[model samples]
Target: MLLTLLWTLQGWVYLAVVFDLYSRRVVGWHMDRKMETSLISRALMMAINLRKPPPGLMHHSDRGSQYASNQYQAMLKQHDLVCSMSRKGNCWDNSSTERFFSSLKREWLTGNLYSTRESAIADVRAYIAYYNARRLHTTLGDMTPIEFEKIA
Candidate 1:
């Protein structure tokens, strides 16, 4: 998600997020002042550590430079994951991530002001926790992501 907290003391912060489609949960995320390969790599690694998904688990993302970087691609290969990229200039292919960002900005971040990077990070962390554990997801039979996981 391209963070719009440009008013922060440190400048704009970019968020790299990995969302699990099964339960509509944000499995991993990272925020940094710059949008770079390292930011995306860290987010991917965090997701791997949390889920340890099977070797053939399909990892889908947009064809962004960060996701296409050699460093990020190497990490995906090392983890034995399969890559699925949305077509260029096609936003519909990745609507789930888009919806997540929309909700994040509208439901959680609208009108919020962050004075520093840490403040933004703290709010994002809190929102992710709420989203995964308590927020009801209509797609998962109206259960929270954690609740759906328990049944699965």
Candidate 2:
């Protein structure tokens, strides 16, 4: 899924994230000035490299053009992932990722005004670290994502 951050001077920084639904963990993420297919492809590559998931794993996302692009679909096919897209105009199908982005903005980026894209990126990186290692989720039995994964 994708989210955008607006820094005071740098304007918008787009983030593409690949989230693990079961553990509510953000497995991969990339940020750039453009919201092109490459943005999401890089994030997907990071997840593929880190997890090395087996074939037949389901990959879900919105029906965005970037996700539907040939390059992105080719990557999914290469990884042997089964792609699932949400219904038209429906966001609930990818609600978990949507909620994660909501938390990121509401809890971490809401009050801050970053002067540079670098600063926004740094702050977002820090938030991801804290989110995975420290923030408790009620859905995960009040444990952090790392903790939930440890015993899962």
lDDT of 2 by residue, 1-152 (tens): 55554555778889889999999999999999888999999999988997899999999988889999999999999999999999998878988888888899999999898899889989899999999999999999999999999999
Reference-based TM-score of each model: 0.94, 0.96
Tens-place lDDT digits, model 1, residues 63-100: 88888889888989999999888888888877887788
Which residue pairs show backbone clashes in model 1?
A: none
- Cα error, candidate 1, residue 103 (Å): 0.8
Q: Mind sharing the TM-score for model 2?
A: 0.96
Give per-candidate clash totals.
0, 0
- lDDT per model vs. reference: 0.83, 0.89
Off by over 4 Å in 2: none
Model 1 earns a TM-score of: 0.94
lDDT of 1: 0.83
Highest lDDT model number: 2
